[model samples]
Target: MRISRLVILGGFLTALLPVALLAVGYTLKTRALMLDTTLEQNELFSKEAALYIDKVLVDHRNVLQFTAQALGADALDPAQASPVLARLRAAFPLFDRILVAPPSGVTAFAVPELADNGQRVAGANISDRAYFQTVLRTNTAYIDPDVLLGRTSGAPVTIIAAPVPGPNGGVSAVLVGTIDLDSLTQLIGRLHLGASGHAVAVTREGVTVAHPNARLVQQRFNFSGTPVWQYLRGADQGRIASYVDEENTTRFAAFATVPATGWKLWLSQQHADVDAEFYQLLASSSLWPLGALVVGILLSVLLARMIARPIETLHATARDIAAGDLDRRAPEEGPQELVSLAVAINAMAQTLQALVVKERGVRAQIESAVTEYGRFAERVADGDFSAQVMVDNAGDLERLGHALNAMSRSLGLLVSEIKLATAQLGSATAEILAATSQQAAATTEEAAAVRQMAASVHELRQAGESVSRRTQAVLDMAQKTEVVAETGLHSVEETIRSAEQGRQRLETLAERVMGFSERTHEIAEINAAVAELAEKSNLLAVNAGIEAAKAGEAGRGFAVVATEVKELAEQSKAATAQVRRIIADIQRSAQAAVIAAEQYAKASDAGVSTSRQSGTSISTLAARVTEASQAARQNLVAAEQQQAGIEQIALAVDNIEASSAQTVSATAQVEQSARSLHDLAQTLDDIIGRVSVRPGAERRVS
Candidate 1:
C-alpha cells in the first residue's frame, strides 16, 4: 500500500497488460481462423466425395444404357439380350443382377438364375416395381430412390433402369441393373478423414445408401427426421453445418448432393476432436507471453527500489528533525524532484533552528526587564517617588518601565493638588446644596401642572381611537363589498355569454331542421315520380297479359311474367304512399321544436338584462361606500397624531417629576458630604508628610 509498491505495481501492469492481451487476442483469432479453415476444408472434401460417388453411379448407368441401346429391338428376345446382360454383369461385379422387363412390366429375362429365397427372378412380376413403372412412363434412365435388398444376393442394392427402344421408336422393354451398395460403403470408409471423421451417402428419401457403419446400410436406416438430413436435404451444393448426432456427440459436417443419384454425401468430424488439435497448437504458442510476464516482474522490483531510495533518505532526516535533532539536514541527491524536496526540507530545518535561538534571547531580555519592573513597583507602593526603573534593551518592557517612573513623579504632585481641591470642593458643595433645594421645589410645581394637562389630552386621545376603529371597520366592509360586487359582475357577464352561445346553437339547430324538411319534400317529389312509373308499368303488364292469352300456348311464360310484374308495381305504389305519410309527420315535429327554442331564447335575453342592471347597481353602491370610508379615515389619522403628541408630553412630565425628586435628595447628601470632605482633606495632608518623595522629605499642612 505504500507509494513505492503502488508505483511498482503500476509499472508491472504497464509492461505485462498489452502482451497478455495480445496473446489472448491472437489465440482467440487463431482459433476462429482455424475453425473456419476446418469447415471450408470439410466442405471441399464433401463436394469431391460427392463428385466421385456420382462418377461411380454414372459409370453403372452408362453400361446399362449402352446395353439397352445395343439391344435395339432384340431386347425383348432372350437369345440376343441374355448374352449382353451376362457380359454387363460379369464386367461389373458391383451389380447384383442384370434383368430385362417387357412393356407389360413383367420380368421376361434375368442374368441371375435364382433369388435369395430360391424363387426365380425371371418369372417374378416386375409390374409393381417403382423403377419399372418409371421406365414405362418417361422412357428414360432412372435410379431408384432407395437401396433395396437384392432378390438374388439378399444384399442392399440400388436399381438403375434404362428404356429399350422398340422397332417403331417407342420404349418396348426396360433394361435394369442392380448395383450393390456395399461398394459405395467401402469407398466412403476408405476416405482419409481424421480420426472420428467419416463420409456418408444417403438417399433423397433419407434412407442410408452407404455408411461406414454397415449395419445402418443393411438395415436401410432412415435419417429423415435427423438434423443431418435436414441440412443435407436442403443443400443444393456443398455447405457446412454443426449438429449433435444420435450418440449426443457434437459434430461439424459438410454436405453435398450427388447429381447422378440425388443422394446426399456428408463428410463430418467430431467437434471435440477438432478443438483438441486447435488447443494443442494454441498452448505451444503461449509460452512467449509467460516469459514476458516473469521478466516484467523482475524489472518492476528494480524500478521500485530506484524510486524509493532517495525518498527514504529524506524521510530519515525529517524524523530526526521532529525528534529535536535540528542540526540534521536532508542529503540533496538522486532525481531532480527528490533533490528539490531535500533542499526544501534542509532549509526548513535551518530556519527553525535560527528561530529557536532568537526566541531564547528575547525571552531572557523579557525576564530581566520583569525583575527590574517588580522592584520599582514595590518602591512606588511604599510612596517613594525618588526611585526609577532602570532595565534596558527590552522591547515593550522598557517602555513600560519608563511609563511607571513618570507616573510616580506625577502621583506626588497629584496628591498635593487633590488635598487643596478637596477643601475648595467642601465650600462649594454647601452653596450648591441650598440652590438645588430651591430649584427642585420649583420643578415639582411645574411637573404637577404638566401632568394635569396630559390627563385631559389622554381623554381626547381615547375618543380619537374609538373613531379610528369605526372608520377602519367601515373601510374593511367597503373593500369586501367591492370584491363581492366585482364577483357578481363577472358572473353576470358569464351568464350573458352562455345565453348567447345557447341562442346561437338553437339557431343552428333550427336551420338544420328546416333544411331537413326541404330535403324531405324533395324525397316526396321523387316518390310521386316513382308512383307514376308504377302505374304505367301496371298498365303495360295488363296489356301484355291480354296479348299472351290471345297468342295461346307459346305465350304462357310471357303471361306468367307479365302477371308477376303487375303485382310488383302494385306493391311499390303502396310503399311510396307510406313513405310520404312518414315524411309529413317529421316536417310537422321539426317546425314545433323550432318554435319552442325561439321562445326559450327570448326568455333568456330578458333574464340576462335584469342581471346586468343588478350588477350595475351593486357597483355603484360599493363606490359610494369606499368614498365615505376614505373621509372617515382622514379624521381618524388627525386624531391619532394629536394623541401621539399628548402621550409624548405626558412621558416628559413624568421624567421631570422623577428628576426633581432626585435633585432634592442629592442636595441633602451634598451638605453631609461637604463636612466629610473637610475632614478627609486634613487627613490626606497628614498622610503625605510620612512618604519620602526625595529621600527623608516631610510635608507640613498650613
Candidate 2:
C-alpha cells in the first residue's frame, strides 16, 4: 500500500475506535447481566423444585394424620387394628407396610404380619426403632433417618410414623407407614436441567435421601461438607452458588430446604451451560463490527489512492530511470505539488540522459580494450599459449594491451616449464597409485586370512569346552556304572539264594497238595462204607414193621423203635452222599494247587539263571565304560593344550594385523601427498599455458 493509503486507513481506524470500545463495553455489560440472569433462573428452578418435593411430603403426611385420626381408640385392639393397617397399606401404594405400635413399645398389629424386610413384626418390639421412639416422644410425625431396603420384592423404604392421640390428650399409639423412596428418587430423577444437570435431596442431617445414582442413595451421601449445602444451611430461601462438584467440575447450583422434612434440594448446572447464552450473544454482536471494519478499510484505501495518484506517476518515471530508461520523464500534471515534483523529476532525467550519452563513449572504449584482453585470456585459459593482444588507440587502454602481450609471452615460457614438471609429477603419481593399490589388495587378503584363523580359534575353543563337558559327563557315568555294577553283583548273589529257598518251599507245597489229594480219596472211600451201613439199617426197620403187623399190639412198640432208627439211618445215608461229593471237589482243588506249585518252582529256577546273566553283562559294561572314560580324559587334556597353542597363534596374528594397519595408514598418506603434488603441477601448467602470448606458435622446454 502507498504511504498515503496507510495514513488514510490509520485515520479511519482512529475514528472507529470508540465504536469498537462501545461494542466491547456492551459485551461485558451483557455478560454480567447474563450471569445475574442465570443465577436468578437457577434460584427460581431450585425454589420450584423445593416446593414440588415439599408438596409430596405434605400430602403423604396428611394421609398419615388422617389415618391416625380414623384409628380412634381401637388402635390398641389387635383384631381391629390389623384390618385397619391392611386397609391403609392397600390404599397407599407407596407404603411398603403399615404398623400400629402402642406406647408400651410393642407392635400388636401389622398390615401383613411382616415388616418391610419380611421379618415378622406383629409381636415384635418397636420401642428401640428410631421412628417409633421419635413419634413416641414428639407426639408428631417421625421421618426415619435411614430407609431400610426390603428383602423380598419391595424397594427401600423409610418409616413415617404419626402418633394417635388418646382421650386424655396424651399419645396413645403410633401409626407407622413405610414410604418407598423409589417414588422420591423418580421425582428427582425426572427433574432434568440443561442437558445433563439435575437435582439431589439430602436429609436434615445431610444424608442423601434421593439421587439419580442408586449407589449414592445407598451411600447416604452427607452433603454438609459441600459449599452449596453450607450456603443453604444459613438460609431458608433458595439461592444460587458457584462451586466445583465432587467430580471436579465447575457448577452453578441453587439450593432450597424441604420445609416438611428439613431436607435440602440442590439444583445444579455445569458452568458451560450457563455461559452458552453469553457467548452466543457476544458472537452475534461481534460479527457486525468486524464486517464494518473491513468496509471502512476498503473505503480508506480507495480514497487514499485517489489522493496520491499524481505522486504515483513520478514514482513510475523514477522506476523507469532506475531500469535504464533514462530518457523517460514524469509528466508535469495533476495537483500543484505533484506537478512540481514531476517537473523536478523531468529536469533530473534530462541532465542524467546527457551524462549517460557521454558515459556511453567512454564505456565503448573501455569495453573494446576489455573485449580484446578477454579474447587473449580465453585462449590462455584453454591451454593455448599462442594468442597475443592487439594494442588499442586509447592511451591507458593501449598500455594495458601492451602489458597483456608481455605477460602472455612470459606465461608461455613458464607454461613450458610447468608442463614438463606436470608430466613427471603425473608419472610419479601413477606409480604411487599402483603401488598403494597392490599393497591395499595384499593387506585385504591378509586381513581375510587372519579373520578366518580367528574364527577357527574361536571354534577350537568352543569345541574344547564341549569336549571337556562331555568327558566330565562320561567320567561321572562310568563311576556311577561301576557302583551300580558292584551293587548288582551283590543283589544277584542274594537273588540266587532267595530263588533256591523259594524252589524248596514250592516243592514242599507240591508234596502237601499231593498228600491232601490222597486224604480226599480216602475220605471218599469212608463215605461209601457209611452209605452201605445205613442201607442195611433201613431194610431191618422195614422187616420189623412187617412183623409188628403180624404180631399185633406186642410187635407194634418194637416196630416203632425200629422205624425211628430207620429214619435216622436214612438221614445218615443222605449225609454220606453229600460228604462224598464234597470230597471229590476238594480232591480236584488239591490237584490244581499241586500243579500251580510245580509251575512256581520252575519259574524260580529260570529267574535265578536270568539274574546271573544280568550280573555278568553289567560287569562287562562297567569295565568298557572305565576304559572309554580314561580315553576321553586324555583327549580332554590334549584339547586344552591345543586351545592354548591356538590362542598364542591368534595373538601373533593380531600383531601382524596391527603392523599391516600401520603400513596401510602410511601408504595412504604418501598416496594423498603424491596426488596433491600432481594436481598442483597440473593447475600451474594450465594457468601459464592458457594465457595468450602469440598465435600459431608452440613453445616447449625439454
lDDT of 2 by residue, 1-702 (tens): 777867686858864896689887988788777767767876788788889877866776778878897877988887877777777667767676777778887776777775545678677676877777888788887666565654332455666889998999779988877766766888888878777588887777777778877877766667778766667677776555577766677787778777777777887888676578678777877877877777777777777776677777788889998888887878887878888888888888889889988999989867766766676677777756565655436577667666766776777787677777777877777777777767766766776776677677667767767876777777777777778877887888889899999899889888988988888888888888889989998998888888888999888898888889899889989999899889988888988888898888889889988988987887787788778778777877877787788778767776776776676677667767767766776776675555444464432111
Across 14-117, the per-residue lDDT of candidate 1 in tens digits comes to 87889978977887888778777877888898888889878877888887888898998999788887888888888888777888888887688788868777
Any idea what lDDT model 2 has? Answer: 0.76
Clashing pairs counted in every model: 0, 6
RMSD of 2: 11.8
Give the distance in Å from residue 376's predicted Cα in candidate 1 to where it truly belongs. Answer: 18
Worst 10 residues of 2 by lDDT: 693-702
Q: What is the TM-score of each candidate against the true structure?
A: 0.50, 0.49
- What does each candidate score in C-alpha RMSD? 19.4, 11.8
Best by lDDT: 1
- TM-score between model 2 and native: 0.49
